[model samples]
Target: MNANNIVDATTRSPARVDEVLDRFFSLSTTRAATLAPAYEALWKTLRSNTNGGKRFRPRMVMTAYEGLGGEDLAAAAHVGASFELLHTALIVHDDVIDRDFVRRGIPNVSGSYRDIAHTAGLSIPTAEHRGMSVAVIAGDLALTGAFRLMGLAETNSATRARLLNILDDAVFASAAGELIDVDFSLYSGVPSVEEIVDMERLKTAVYSFEAPLQAGAVLAGAPESVISALGKFGREIGIAYQIVDDLLGVFGDEHATGKTTIGDIREGKRTTLIAYASTRPEWSAISHLVGKSSLTPAEAQIVRTELEACGAKDFTERLAGEHADRAVAALADGNVPQRLVDELTPIVAAVLERVR
Candidate 1:
C-alpha cells in the first residue's frame, strides 16, 4: 500500500481521539476527587504527565480495531481510552523508578510534585521524598482506573475478560523486564545482543504493542486465530519501535525528541545498538564512551559516528524493517479484511520510520 492510503486508513479522526481523551480525563478527575487534598495534588501530577503524549498506545488499539473490521467508532474509542489510561499509569510509575525529571518537555509526575513541595519551602530531600511518595500512590490509582474503565466498556463479558487478562499479563511481563533492566544497569557485565533483544521484547514490545492490538481485536469479536496473528504482528512492530527509539536516543534532534542526544549512553542503557557496537574491535573507543556520564558533545558525536562506522545503526534500522515486513506478512495470513490490512501497512511503516 502507498503512504497516502496507509495514512488515511490508520489515521484516526481528530474528533474521535479527542473524545477518548475527554472520557479518560473525566473519569480520572472524578476518581481522583474522592482522595485527600495531598492525593489530589498527585492526581494533578498524573494528569499533567498523561496530557501530551503522542497517544501512541491508544492509537494502536483503535487501529487494530479498525483492522479487525470493527465499524463501531464509539466502541473503538473506549478500547483506546482504556489503553491510554493503562499507559499513563505505567508512565507515572516508570518515571518514579527512572527518577526521570522530564517528559514531553514538561516535568514528570514525581518532578512536578517535587517542584511544588520546593516552592512551598520544603527542604530538598524532604520534598523529593514526599513527591515520590505521592507519585507512587497516584500511579496505583491510575492503574485501578484502567481496570475500572475496562469493566465499564460497552462490550460483552467474554470479550472484556479476555482483554483484561491480556492487559494484566502484559503488565506483569513488562514489570519483570523492567526489573531485569534494573539488574543489568546495576551490574558491570555486558550482555550479548541476543540477551538485549530478549530484554527489549519483554520490556517494550508486549505491553506497548501486542497487548493493545490483542485487546482491540478481542473487543471487536475477532476470531482467536486473527487475534493471535495480530499479537504476533504487534510483537514484531513493538520491538522495532524500541530499536528505533534507541536509535533516536543517540542520533535524533534533542528539541524534537525531548531528550538529550545520546542520553541512553550516559544512562548506560543496554540497548541493541550498544550490544552491536561492543562486538566490533574497531569501535573500542565507542565502547569506552558508553558508561561515562561526563561525555562532551563532541565525544558523544564521535561515539555515535563509531556506532555508525561499526554498522550498528544500519543493522538496527534493517532489523526494524524486517519486523515491519513480518507484521505486514502476518496481516496477510490472518484473513483480515482488506480495508484493515490496508490501514495497518502504513502504520507499521510509520512505526519504523518515526523520528521520535
Candidate 2:
C-alpha cells in the first residue's frame, strides 16, 4: 500500500468523530443554556477552542482498529473521539499552565475572557486573573467531558472499562509529566538531558502516542504482545514528535506552527535543547536572556544564534533521529503485521518532517 495514501485515508480528521463531537458540544451548550447565559457562553467558547485540530489522536484509534482487522467503525469512532476530547482538555489546561491566552493564533478561552474583561475596564492584572479563572473552569469541563465521551462508545462494559483505564493512565501520566515540566523551570540549575527526556516522554509521548495506539489495539481486541509492541512504537515516536515540536517552538515559522517561537524561550522551559546548551560554554553568552519574560526579538535572535553555534540544534536533531529509528525498529516485533509496519513506518519520518 502507498503509505501516503494510507495516511491520507486513515488520518484526514474523521468526519464521524467530528459529528460525534458536534453533537456532544450541542447537547452540552443546551444544558448550560438552561442554567445561565454565561454558562452557555463558556461552553460555546470551549466548542470554539476545540475546533481546527488535526485530530491525530482519534485517527490513531481508527488506524490501529482497522489495521488489526476490527470491524465496528462506529464504536472505534466514539472511542477515538474521546481521545480527541482528552487532547483538547489537556491543551486547554496546558495553556493555562503556560499562561497563554492564544492557541492556533487565535484568542483561546482565557484570551477571549481576558479581552472582554479588559474592554470592560478591568485592570490588566484583574483581567488576566479573570481570564485564567474562566479558563480553569473551561478546562475542568473539557476534562470531565472526555470521560463522558468515552462512556458514549457503543461497546461492552468490560471493553469500555479497559478503555477508561487507558484514558485514566494517560491523564495520570500527563499530570505527572506536566508537574515535572513546571518544576524544571524552578531549578537553579538546568535539568539533565535524561531528566528532560523523561519529562518530555511523560508530558506528551504517553498520551499522544502510546495511549492512542494502545486504545486502538484494545478496541480491536488484539493480543497482548501486539498491544505491547504498538505501545513501544508509540512511545518512541511520541518522544521524537515532541522533540521536533520543541525544535519548532524555537526556530519554526509562526504561521506554520500557529505558535510564537519566542514563548518557549521566555518561559525558560528546560527542554532538551536548553539542557544540552547549558553544558556548552557558549550558553553563557545568552544565559541571562533565556527566561526573561520581556525578551526582545533581537535578544531571542541572539539566543538562537548561540544555540546554533553551540550545536544544540544539531544535537537535538540527531537525538530526534535516534528516537525515530528506535520507533521503526519497534515494528520488527514478530507479532506486529508487516502491513501495519509499512503503514506506520512513514509516521516516524513525518514526526521529524515538520522541523525540516
Best by lDDT: 2
User: After superposition, which runs of candidate 2 have C-alpha atoms over 4 Å from their true positions?
Assistant: 1-13
Each prediction's number of clashing residue pairs: 0, 0
For candidate 2, the per-residue lDDT at 301 reads: 96
Index of the highest-TM-score prediction: 2
**lDDT scores in order:** 0.76, 0.86
The TM-scores of all predictions, comma-separated, are 0.91, 0.93
Worst 10 residues of 1 by lDDT: 1-10
Q: How much is 127 displaced in model 1, in angstroms?
A: 1.3
Candidate 1: tens digits of C-alpha lDDT, residues 259-282? 677678888788888878878885
Task: State the displacement of the C-alpha of residue 186, model 2, in Å, after optimal TM-score superposition.
Answer: 2.3
Q: What does the lDDT read for residue 211 in candidate 1?
A: 90
TM-score, cand. 1 vs. native? 0.91
